[model samples]
Target: MTRTPASRRDDYPVFRRLQTRWMDNDQYGHMNNAVHYALFDTAVNGWLIEEGLLAETGAEAYFLVAETGCHYHSELAFPGWVDAGLRIAHLGTTSAVYHIGLFAEGSGTAAADGRFVHVHVVRGTHRPMPIPEAARQVLARLFPAA
Candidate 1:
């Protein structure tokens, strides 16, 4: 089967720098596969919080992870830093698909790439809700041009 080429830093519009913890490494001496998903979650949610789109508490609406996926191109080990590049692949009324690329610091090619799907929902009810206009505006910055 053919494989999609790994993404590059230039493909994403926003980035978050994250440090790999010692515990992140597995017996093989490389970062465990699960950590890649954590980094992706951190990058996207951290961006949202920084942009004032999400609140840690008492928010009327917030996002919940509906799905996640990853493709590894190389190994990432602990005692290093990673740059997670993010972009919006799809924007719907109540959900958004995020594309993330994890690259070693100062590297142009991605070490891993992944997709995260978030569903906007009411805080208490947890019912799907339209993405807030304010949040949409901020998210638009990372969306690809028409």
Candidate 2:
């Protein structure tokens, strides 16, 4: 079954503004398909870092992307900015599923939407590990009420 894309910016609880690079566009004159995943990765990890849940290095644990998929509703190209809207769809012991909506600046509907799954792992061994309590608390803030 196909899922409908989020139709409003307010569907997400957090937003991250990203400047689109000219290089992000493909010969088709639109952002490359792969670039959507890059934006999703940047939005989620950047938020984690901002919340003190992740570090560039020397952290006890960190998250690694396990799965990701995107659905496009409209086109996005360079020479513009993207507002990535983020929320936690599922938060488990060792992983979380992040839902993201990519909206063209000032647009209420998402140009694209996707899910990114991150699994917490030990820094050195990379073994699966429970998400840190501190991180969980912070992530919980992104959970929208059902």
TM-score of each: 0.94, 0.93
Candidate 2 lDDT over residue span 69-141, tens digit each: 9988999999999999999999999999999999999999999998999999988887999987888899999
RMSD to the hidden true structure, all candidates: 1.3, 1.5
Quantify all predictions' global Cα lDDT against the true fold.
0.92, 0.91
Q: Pick the candidate with the highest TM-score.
A: 1
Best by lDDT: 1
Model 1 lDDT per residue over 31-114, tens place: 999999999999999998889877668878889999999989999998999999999999999999999999998899999999
Error of 2 at 10 (Å): 1.4
**Candidate 2 lDDT trough over 10 residues, lowest sum:** 2-11
